[model samples]
Target chain A: MSQLANVLNITKAPQPSCQAQRLTASKSLSARQQQELRAILEQGLPQVAQPYLAIAEQINASPDQVLAQIALWQEQGLIKRFGLVVKHRQLGFKANAMVVWDIADEQVDAVAKLLSSCPEVSLCYRRPRRLPDWRYNLFCMIHGTDRAIVEAQIAAIVDKFALQAVNKDILFSVKAYKQQGARYTKKGNCHG
Target chain B: MDKQSRQATTPVAELTALDKRIINLLQRGLPVVERPFLEIAQQLGCHEDEVLERLNHLMTNKVLTRFGPMFDAVCLGGAFTLAALAVPEPEFERVTEQVNSFDEVAHNYRRSHDFNMWFVVGAESAEQVNNVINDIESKTGLPVLNTPKLEEFYVQLYLPA
Candidate 1:
């Protein structure tokens, strides 16, 4: 591991909201089976004693086969996360802010590493800076139960990172018009 | 602004202690097993039927927008991009409806900025994604600033609700 990775690995927040995680990107899909698996997985497992068997029956696969495929897809990074996707605001995390930062090219990577390590940051990604109109490239999402908690968290990150001079914008999500998992090839999962 | 959009300011009312516990545990993930809910119930020291019933209720009531596998669209041979539009105040509602009419739009959020309406477009391929963008621009008569992820450092979302 590089020095930075080593440093980030050991840096643990006392009150961790999310584990210090890394996301590996995938550019292409491999098989049709995976696609079908994804669509079925999106609807999620049925609430039953033999959920895997139920899923298997849909695609003409066995229970063990379904389980193995899920494990394989996760390891291969096709499925980012297989769990409950809650409406966060419904869960008392009403204050959600997407903080975008304009960082110097050379420092962006190092800064991103540090920002990702913070407990408050649920998501940290380096996106392209659209010149003139949109200059902020670094995006991080912070969620709190209320506005005061969110503001305090942001202030602390700024102070800790010496980011007083950085140009950034905090865009709190005003409303969610539409939110759902990607329906990639919806043909695979629909039984009706 | 509209009936479809939920206000992000207020918490959903009438959540029991068990509901909170279920939300917190389910976020981690349910194992791939013969009886997954039973395992979760065992872990939480609750009845399996209660877990199943509460989960079904949560989804039915939109407390849980989605449950199950979260796929990286890009990984599944799909194109994904974040696009935004600065709609005129007078036509905000109309424009929102116009932009959201497309099935490819997976997520849309009204944010506090001039480019106020931000949404994510997911399609089977890059060409399709662009087609959706073009359709949105022409339909709404507003330029869509499409920004895709250049690099992802970290993305894991788990909240204790």
Candidate 2:
């Protein structure tokens, strides 16, 4: 294995969260199934062909059943999206920023609709405002190679959109304490 | 996206308490393994098949947007950043549509502000990240302020509540 891979393998997984206490699901699950689910969530999804089948074997279920159930949940929209986690910065794109805009409340939806469509914008959300201290409501992220290019995009938005009447702020990320999506399984399984 | 768009999917009030509990549990994320759902079932003291059934039900209903691993882009040898633009009231939709089309952009949402369009961009390289920003500038005619993370204190949006 490459030196880095070897290092990664040996490094004791950052300690398991003291929060690893078993959390109860809504309806009680069978003892075997509960153990399987908890282990999966706490560790990670299996990485292999027919991963679902592998899971079934662990829990003593047929592969078809596992596949069917997963499909069902996905169709229901309980499962949002499933994609790979690309560790940013490790790839050398270190610069990161958070840009906020003050879109008129009346036009906010229309404006948000526009932003959400952009693939460059990864995460977008609306948070409660703190008045003059923070007026810009629409938020998005634009990652790039340098600050100048990033700035140019913002300037273009102002000019093209004629957003002179609103306020703006760019909050850049410095040190990422933790960056992971919600587990959607249980609590006390990891540090919050 | 904002809460409004979410409302169209399904009213949270309609979900059963058991559904809510399952949702709450999975929101944090399932185990990272070959058979995470099975593992979760075991821990929850239920049949693995049942756990999968519930998850499927929730996903199809649109109660959960996704269920998967969220990697730290920074750790993966890539560049990512967050930025927002103040879109004009009239041209908001057009500009947002344009921004959302970029392959590098993962997701974007609307906030209440003059510069109200917020989104995130991920790229295989730093240069690509910048290129995406520049592309947005020309495409949407908006100044893309690249807000590189200066100090990430803490960011965990998932709440079991």
Go through the candidates in order and give each one's C-alpha lDDT: 0.72, 0.52
Give the clashing pairs for model 1. Answer: none
For residues A1-192, write the lDDT of model 2, one tens digit per residue. Answer: 142233232211121222212333223345567456535533444534346667777877676655554443334333222442222332223445567778777766555545443434444555435464456666666654456676676677666456667677776543331122222212111111
Interface RMSD of each: 7.1, 14.8
What is the per-residue lDDT of model 1 for residues B1-161, given as tens digits with 9 covering 90 to 100? 55554474455656778887887787666776778889989999999999989988888877886677765555556667778898888999999889878888866888888888988777777898899999999999998887887666653454445
What TM-score would you give candidate 2 relative to the actual structure?
Answer: 0.43
Q: Number of clashes in model 2? A: 157
Question: Which regions of candidate 1 deviate over 4 angstroms?
Answer: A1-7, A10-38, A58-60, A117-119, A176-192, B1-13, B16-18, B38-50, B88-94, B138-141, B153-161
DockQ metric for all predictions: 0.47, 0.04
Task: Compare the candidates by TM-score and give the number of the best one.
Answer: 1
